[model samples]
Target: MSSLISTPIAPTSHTLLKPNRNTLLRGDSLLPKRLSCTRTRSSSTTRALLSTTKESVLKDFHERRALKIISGLQNLNKENVASVVTAADKGGATHVDIACDPDLVKLATSLTSLPVCVSSVDPAAFSAAVEAGALMVEIGNYDSFYEMGIVFSPEQILNLTKETKRILPSMTLSVTVPHTLSLPDQIKLAEQLEQEGVDIIQTEGGKGSSPSKPGVLGLIEKATPTLAAAYAISRAVKIPVMCSSGLSAVTAPMAITAGASGVGVGSAVNKLNDGVAMIAEVRSIADSLSLSTGRHIVSEKNTLRL
Candidate 1:
């Protein structure tokens, strides 16, 4: 009887109160608006930085004397990579190409302000490297693979280019036309790549050449295939053409004269065991390009005067 003192306690109001629509709307309007503004500013800043970087990276190419020093796509030796980067920086190179690794990009950026380009055949691998500060990504430099008897077909290269563009639509992309193909096929591939929005086409033929002689004549013989590819593909496409492989101080300027907007030198500079020699090689190539560009400008001016 004592426990039944159920004087009907007024039914406790157990109903949970819901937030008012107006109150919820006001709450959402506050912090979210500030976050949106912040995101917009950050996006705008990133775009501006990218534009400036691209402009600076392409400055020398537009001037038709871009000297890109490559350290090899498979060369991961940090010490060698560092030496190559240092040589390129000190040798007045406009760009540097290294393997597609975020750490390598960081290392190169730390060593020099030159636009660092990462090389990879895997399209997916470029994202992290680009995020790490690589201003350009290349899809060729297949010499090491060629040594292993591996080669990329035209369809394979096209698909890779498509995928890369999908992933990094705004990035500067350079694709190489495989030297295994006939020269006509190379020009065809170059035209196809240009149609796919490729910013540059790089020609390679060093792995295919076995010079039969020595000295300057041998150098010319070594560079003939790539120079031919450059001359043909440059005429077939509207974008910049980078003539690479088996080139030296003797033939780098010849590449520019063959309608290449730029020249990429690798073994000539990277093969040297001495860093001083590496730097000297890069300087020689750079000087050769400068002299070639100067002569071209003078020739144009004289033509105008005439």
Candidate 2:
């Protein structure tokens, strides 16, 4: 009978109700609203830094006599990939474009501090390549298909946007339109690509066409294809447009004047095996573009400078 009486336990104070080991270490030091405000300020600071860096880099790249060599290295082997990227870097390339292969991406990332771009026919492969460390991605290098009997029609190009968006919604997408299309079609495709959320729309010279070659330069000759696509796409979309494939230092200014935000050249750098020679070529192109850009800037500043 004496042992049957039950004693009631006193309620512990809230302060004494200690949190679990996990909970104890997981509390935020600031209130939710304050935390959010602090995060916003930090984000703004970071963004400002990044923007300033990008502007300075672009300015220097434009102001100096250097062409951003977009060297195309299709080899899947890691060692070959490293060698090509290393050569491009020593040659003064702004960025390197590699085929969609995971090993190549790792090699590129490890070998150089330059921006890495991944090109792929498969959206999933592009995603993997980006995850592997690619800062950019190019959808077309039409030269690969020239002999494969595979053509990158307007429809096919548009479908690529749909697929890429579905797979990698936030990726910085760059879609290239085959130069084979007529000017009208090229413009139309450029407009469509812009509307589809592509970050950059590149135009090529199409079918054995070198934009600067003696007579084969249909669009490349009159500065029609790349210029047309850039003008159309730049006007249609807020994203940047790059004129690539057949561009050179001599014609780079025209490409920029026609509305290209940047130009991408492959053969001008890739065909050369010497890094120093490559850098010199890029530097010459960069110099030409900078001088031209400087003239435009001076004209605009003349009114203000006075």
Candidate 3:
């Protein structure tokens, strides 16, 4: 890696963060009045940007404790999508990750002031979502593809990043490093992604993992793959690493401890049957991420200029 792109974070030892009380609140409770984006479709694209000054997604990634709630890339039901988006913002999530569909992006934007991110493996899918008010775009979670025995090669991942950038160069781009790759290869891919102009790198596990232990130990065992990848890859790339998949409130702090700037949770929130349950789960993850990440935060913010 060139010196300009060699800025990687060194993982540090950090204690597990204690869980906070689960205080569920209505979506309206966060503000005296609800916040809505009144901009028309044409103007929304102008306001939705990859970065902002004070509370930009970039700043949150720099802070290293941001929590992202995933509503599934395949989930398209209007009611279910709305419920998940409401729960994510009300539960204190830094952002909500949803399917890269124009309709879903519009629905998410109509509901909250929090940054709305859309995800997909196809680069063509992002254009409509961006026009619909999506502020962030992500490629490849790959967790859903495991059941179909589909795996992405490093070359495919790099191409996806390139194509997505070609479509929306200014959009905050996040690409997931397939957990299927060896740790060293994962790191190499991350470094290349930085060179490709991806703003963030996300790591995933759980679909391909089967935990042998039970209870709390089982949860840790389940999260081990992604957490380990985050430790290795975050140390090899200048961009912020978002540790995701198979993570719960119990292991979220472990991700930040491993040098990830944030955690992306999917099934933990989306799998819940009710909106209230989803809100509670989101809060729990936020609680786990309350640890002091002072050292890693300082290192990343200074080394990263993208």
- Per-residue lDDT of 24-52 in model 2, one digit per residue for the tens? 33545433767766867886996776566
Error of 3 at 66 (Å): 1.1
Model 3 agreement with the true structure over 79-182: per-residue lDDT tens digits:
88898899888787888999989988989999888888999887777777877888888987666666666788888778778877766667788999988888
Colliding residue pairs in candidate 3: none
Per lDDT, what order, best first? Answer: 1, 3, 2
Please report, as a residue range, the 10-residue window in candidate 2 with the lowest summed lDDT: 1-10
True-structure lDDT of candidate 2: 0.64
Error of 2 at 124 (Å): 1.0
Off by over 4 Å in 1: 1-45, 291-306
lDDT minimum window of 10 residues, candidate 1:
1-10
Q: How do the candidates rank by TM-score, highest first?
A: 1, 3, 2
| lDDT for 118 (candidate 1) | 97
Clashes of each: 0, 4, 0
Candidate 3 lDDT for residue 135? 80
Where in model 2 is the C-alpha error above 4 Å? 1-68, 77-84, 206-224, 291-306
- Listed in order, each prediction's TM-score against the native is 0.82, 0.67, 0.78
Q: Per-residue lDDT tens digits of candidate 1, residues 20-136?
A: 456434443554777767767886998898778777888778778898999999999989999999999998788999999999999999999989999988777788898799999
Indicate which candidate wins on TM-score. 1
